[model samples]
Target: MSISAPDVTPDVTPNAPWWRSAVLYQIYPRSFQDSDGDGIGDLNGIAARLDYLVDLGVDAIWISPIFPSPMADFGYDVEDYCGIDPRFGTLADFDALLAAAHARGLKILLDFVPNHSSDQHPWFRESRASRTNPKRDWYLWRDAAPDGGVPNNWISDFGGPAWEWDEATGQYYYHAFLKEQPDLNWRNPDVRAAMLDVLRFWFARGVDGFRIDVLWHMVKHADFPDNPLNPAWHVSMGEMHRVLQRHSTDQPEVHAIAGDMRRIADDYSTPGEERVLIGEIYLPLERLMHYYGQDESGVHLPFNFQLIDARWDARTLAQMIADYEAALPPGGWPNWVLGNHDRPRSATKRGAEQARVAAMLLLTLRGTPTLYYGDELGLEDAVIPPDRVQDPRELREPGLGLGRDPVRAPMPWDAGAHAGFSTAEPWLPLGADWRTRNVAAERDDPASMLSLHRALLALRRRHPALGVGQFRLIEAEGDVLAYERVCGDDRIVVALNLGATPHPVILPPGAWRLLLSTTPDPFTDTLAPNQGVILQPER
Candidate 1:
């Protein structure tokens, strides 16, 4: 009897599609690193950390904003769409960062502020020059109220009225964030073309894609009708949330604009690869999927924020998982995010000690996982002094505690002065106990949350089932969450204990083998508190 071995030809390099099995790590640039000793992070700092990112096993990086801005709302307020801020280094620094990133097999995606521009932007300046200016229609401007007051009762996200009175033009300009960040009139053809040109400029510079900021708010009602008031007086940060925002944002026409933006992205695509366009949408699931469009012609991935909204229950987790999987377009890829600069870090939200469990869930989920800066180190929210509050919303609504500055503090890189983030007085104060939570300390400890993250990401890279496999919810009771990831000949069951107490989970009896776990000793036949287990199904 003769035995034959299966023939294995040379593995061809797979074409890298934008959304297929990609892990995107979002870098809040200003808080990521500082190289110029200016007490603020810049592109140079990001370039220096390419190896750190490459070692972490993420496929790509999505940097928040480094574009030229007045820093009114950080970099979300774009002053020059095609230019890099001097504070963040010159355009050459960005080009070098892109080059170095690509060389290290990392793709770079930048934040695109399409919904609005800094009031100081030349276009906005031109628009506000006069009612008859050629660019007067670039931004959303309307006449004063009948009572000679400001426009409508629409509230800005940063607090105060959405419309700002422009004395020179005798009209009010609309801004959904800050008065200085005027909303662009997407209704205007010229404005659309100009925004597209901004995309082209970066694409030509070798940018992989864009994470559109406030994407759903690009289009507003042509009539500029006052938004209906919300009957529910929900309070999160302490401010009275009385105003209803029905008509001001998330308009239906936003989809059409998204489709157009998709077309613009398509124009810049390579042979068979898709250009990435991730929309920063905060709407409910039903409305969120619309950004992808029916035929997958809109945004590549409208961020699924289920983890952000989930309350850490087996039932909630199972249902949200099913709903999100069902909501995707046939070939549409899914993405998961637990934290961002705008929201509280998952560590703080899920209890500082439970951060490991949150990381396990985020990494094992059936989609690209986005890890916010400082999250891997289990960094908690900083305590922002009332006098040092920078967020306009927090200033306006003093009692709400609604500001985002706490979560946007400098990353703890070392135990040195300023945590090695900056030599000068840091822009934001470092978190308390930085000595223990700093990256330097965590890098040396194999049991640290940072090390666990690195191990999980490494495991994810080796297992295709975790990256692009179909997710099946497995049966589990109480706070135990179980799921199976299957891809072709690979299959693995991932069980997670989201509670503080150890939970026993009976495997679907087979040749069960532990693949990975957040617990220090997962293979010891013990499930520790907030432990996670990835078991290979027995053949």
Candidate 2:
């Protein structure tokens, strides 16, 4: 029989920040929902879906970059940091969206691309105009090598050399990602001040927070030394993996920069207006802890992506979670992510059954969980035809399956024309099975993946133990992984069978009642294959 979420409300502390136990939903603006029939999602489109997000039970939404850009790297390359892209909408439209979201008690987070700006940005245009220009030092520029080749051996994240030659200026500029995107010189005091002002601009406009793009890549070694070659690098890896990036990323000075951003966020924090700072960092857990800053003044939440790349097995995931929990600095809150615009979706990486188990693990874990859009409907990677591929990464490196276009497909609202995303043709293709997998189709199905997510999120909100309680690993062996979350008198035991075989549930001596289960079967001593459940002590 199908199980439903119990009617309960969790006790929340009055002064505590909402992000500590909140569920953040990531929205790719171009793909979420299109309002103007332009085949691209705009601010109005997102505003229209605010109720949908509210119904889904997410506390906040983290939208990818929506700033004015040339679309060379989608929205990551910002041309105007302070203005919204025309494709999305005007500033008034954004204000309306923010106000609407806040009205529903939902927070808003915009992607902050501080590491690099579009080549068309006025700052970069002036900096590239002449070497002696006042803004020349605003971006990284260097003279060519003796042989007139590239400046250094640095490689772009897309592929090939990271440096691009400027024929007019006769110098090279650095870009960590695309040649059309120039890296900003954060070492310059004026550049830092300007980027910090960008944060203040949003906070002043009532934006809740920011999800910083490439936070660790902002600071580079002062000497600009060549990165060492990676011995473990293989041909199968991306070209950027050839070098260890020892001097190019994760520099010592980055912490100071993070601290500066944190101070700005704090400046705007009042009793009810608590601004959060989330850094998108992909580093080892040990090094990732430093982003929290000294005295806990750094980024509020450094996005944890270990689950995205971790092995989808019982023991491996359990150990990884423990290690991450142990590595957080004092007073540092934790967050988790299953997928984003850059990586494959959880359902695509693991099968549909395992994805349900993953959803249980994500919401029940002792941290804020960020859910990628479309994963709730159990959407898989869209099949992009060769002619229809839009991702520059895949276009640059074909056949490697590195293209993110598949995961960035349009959100299927219904089975109508273009899956009800837009009247016009979408910029990207929709999934093949949108007819049955769309949100409209699964909204009422009690056993659908969408329903499972709603139930899990409802359960998380109803229990203090699952929200901000202590986490203790009860068992992690073979196909089963069990953990207990205890908050004073409220205690929850989360058990999962990650493998495709039944595993006996091993709980403490106390009698337990099954609160929810991924499978339709009733509570039993054994957990069915690819099943997960939440239990509480029988008082």
Candidate 3:
């Protein structure tokens, strides 16, 4: 049965799309929960945890790639887009998981990798079989320079030349990420049709939507020119940042791809069962809006990652939020993300105290919000032993701390061995404090981070103003950042003290009731240090 949006958010129409007011939870499958004692998570593991997510109040779950892959860039290198990897599970297992999720009012979003595929993929194999092969145009390939050097100065995100020599074909192929993950030539009509059909396959399987990986990198310059050097580049930055990527990414042609994707997704939509398309883009807010497409026909949400990289302070965040709101095209819905598989955990970046504050902000802000798995427990970056580091980026760029292993630690379920995540040693390490910070410890504690997240989510469900309403920035100065969410006659205010010192909050003229707070302090004219509160004007 379709989830009744009206049953959750008051005054919401049954016809209204669920995604606009939904809170999405992201599950890094390799780390969420492991079954079969294999020390790696799988589809069944996620199905077993459905009740937990439903209880936590997330409307949907956006899982990272589970398609068959070489695991070179970990699942980003798709070997078979239609089949499920045995490491994760089979197609039947995925079907069962989808049914279980929908039965409990949850939607599932798959990760789509349209820009590239593993070199092992049959398509790539056939394309590289011979230069005269019918599929040679399926991927980006060019002849070596007059000096037999690389075709261009393009650099891979994983470092070194983006072009790799294919001895079999006597040509250089481009890979924006890893050599094993060759870029697909989107310019090829056949490539577009095949990828679009991939979406059709899953949509037919009841997949709710997709979070397209590297949406901006789907198309590159036609001439394959050298990317300009970044004047601000420094040794501290990743080697990819050495170039400005002016001609390599966010190309104008990519917007059309996004539109094509949106049209395919729309074909799968119903009144309340609308499918969503979320693009994983990392660009300036102005340029990012283009993914929304002309007249909002593009991706439903372009993924606002501003919060992930923003300075966790009043002034900086305030300006960013304002700028983002201003930059959004008319009728475009905004979203917020603080942490994900690729970035550091919020607790690791802002400390435990401020992580709670960040949570309050994420939940109370306007538009859709995606919560990373384990964030509700305030999970920090787990300490990875040198031998346990499995991220390819970390292996390639040793000692740079660019590895994502730390943030991708296994979810701490309880105090048992491996923090109850698996029966055997997990693929990655659990946080050292897992014993006390696990879900079993925090589930019943009102003051625990998990409980706080639960309360905020429950609050959003009860108040449309908090979930999908107009936002107005009230004050952003010193240590306090305040905003208001309004819908019809319902009005609520959120205030955060981003510093270690107590900050006085001058509520807008009206009697107000404290709905929730990060700190245990009773409602007063002042907020405790590192505290955040949701308030409503008393009638």
What would the C-alpha RMSD of candidate 3 be, to one decimal place? Answer: 4.4
Which pairs clash inside model 2? none
After superposition of all CA atoms, the RMSD between model 1 and the true structure is 5.4
Error of 3 at 187 (Å): 0.1
Model 2, C-alpha of 16: deviation from truth (Å): 1.3
Number of the candidate with higher lDDT, 1 or 3: 3
Per-model CA lDDT versus the true structure: 0.82, 0.90, 0.90
Model 3: residues >4 Å from true position, as ranges? 1-14
Summarize candidate 1's per-residue lDDT along 245-333 as a digit string, tens digits. 67777888788878887887888898544578999998888888888886877898898888986888766787778778876766577
lDDT tens string, model 2, 318-389? Answer: 778777777777778778888999999899889899999998999998888999999999999999999999
User: Candidate 1 lDDT (Cα, whole model)?
Assistant: 0.82
Q: What tens digits encode model 3's per-residue C-alpha lDDT throughout 155-229?
A: 888878899999987999999989999999999999999999999999999999999999999999999888989
